[model samples]
Target: MRVTVLGTGAMGAGVAQSLLREGHEVTVWNRSPERAAPLGGHGATVATDAATAVERAEVVLLTLFDTDAVVDVLEQAAGDAPTDAVWVQCSTVGVEGTETVVQLAEKYGITLVEAMMLGTKAPAEQGKLTMLAAGPAEVLERIDPVLRAIGAKTVRAGARVGDGTALKLAANAWIASITAATGQSLAVARALGIDPALFLQAIDGTASDSAYAHTKGESMLAGEYSAQFALDGLRKDIGLITDSARATGVSTTLLDALGRVYADASAAGHGSDDIAAVGTAFTKD
Candidate 1:
């Protein structure tokens, strides 16, 4: 399988490396040429532009930051993409933005699959991320092997383009909500003079135990603010959840509240920090 990966960020490079490990011919492109250099030694070609990278690839994986970045690259590659190419959009853009990609791909007669991954950088690199995919059944079938190379599990939400995006937003909402609750609860525990470790241990003993909570709890305890998922990114995902819920006539008060918490964290200058830093927002002065 020939693969072209755009964006070359942590997630993008990780995906490219996964493909290379699978013996696929992978070409990677980043806006800053230097960002793509690290992949060159991995037997992956680095392209100076999106068009050149995507030109001859059978599968194009987009792990861009947001919808705007995705549009910018596609616009630059307008007339150069192979007509029968399969575009796997792995970014977690909102529903409306994903629908636009579907429309544009249809206009170009290309196969577009909405593939939003669950898990962060390490899992992506280890090919253990879970992929939520939706699009034409034929397209999913054609790319099953490629998807399997990067994901340990792939769930087919439905055959609609935005279905995958919706599923991603809902999943992210759960992540944000649980993270916020954990952060707030730990703050209360500290206020009452309970050790954070004991609080985590107590929680881990119950049915409320979850991988998401454990990971965030450990990060919070250690005060690690690395960008596994940046605060601003979670803010964006929460906003998407609110918007999608509203569009579908669903109540989004909890999501809205979580979005505000993240917005506050970003406003306090932690936007680029990992979302686990939300714990700091509840700290005493």
Candidate 2:
């Protein structure tokens, strides 16, 4: 497959490398060119500008920051892409953003596939992401090779363009809740004069145990806040989640509290750190 990946942030870079490993001819571009430089050594062709990136591409992958970035980049690059190119939108842009992307695809006469990926750096690097996809059957089939290179599984959300984004928001709500709950548990343990590691040990093989809890908890315990996924990225997703929840008549009580905790973490200069930094909000005064 001749593929072009735009916005080579952490996840985008991972996706590009995964494609290269599968022997796909991959072209990559990023707003900050340095971020895309590393992939050149991994067999990806680094494009100097967005317009040149997709000139020879059969598939265009988007892993940009949010709605505006997606819109901005595609506006510049989509015109230059091959007319029949299949576009895989891998950003976590919410329901409204997906609508805008759909409109953009329509304007260009391109096939759009909404593929919201699940998992963070490790999964993306290891080619094990779960892809939530929505698109026409023929288009999905056309891009199956590209999807398989970067995803362990492809879950069809629905035929509607925004269905994948909707499903992604719902999944992220659970992730935000569980991550915040883990931070709260670890914080309470330390404040009560108990070793937080012991709290992890107590739940270690119990029905209450979760792999995600231990992963985020260990990072919090060691204060290793380096990002596998940045705190600000999760904060953005939470905002999208709450907006969707409110529009659907769902209660925003838990999401509102989670939002505040994460907002404090971001405000305190941990926005670029991993989400385990949320533990700081609960632990610090």
Measured by lDDT, the strongest candidate is 2
The clash count of every prediction, one per candidate, is 0, 0
Clashing residue pairs in candidate 1 (N, C-alpha, C atoms within 3 angstroms): none
Please provide TM-scores, in order, for all candidate models, with all chains considered together: 0.96, 0.98
Model 1, 168-220: lDDT tens digits are 98899888988888888888988999887777888776887877778898899
**TM-score leader:** 2
What's the CA RMSD for each of the models?
1.2, 0.9
Off by over 4 Å in 1: none
lDDT of 2 by residue, 1-285 (tens): 999999999999999989999989999999999999999999999999999999999999999999999999989988898888998999998988888999998898888988899989878988999999998888999999999999999999998889899899989898888888899999999999999899899999999999999999999999998899899999999999999889999999999999999999999999999988999999666
lDDT of 1 at 96: 85
Candidate 2 colliding pairs: none
Off-target runs (Cα >4 Å) in candidate 2 are none
User: All models: lDDT?
Assistant: 0.86, 0.92
Candidate 2 minimal-lDDT segment of 10 residues: 276-285
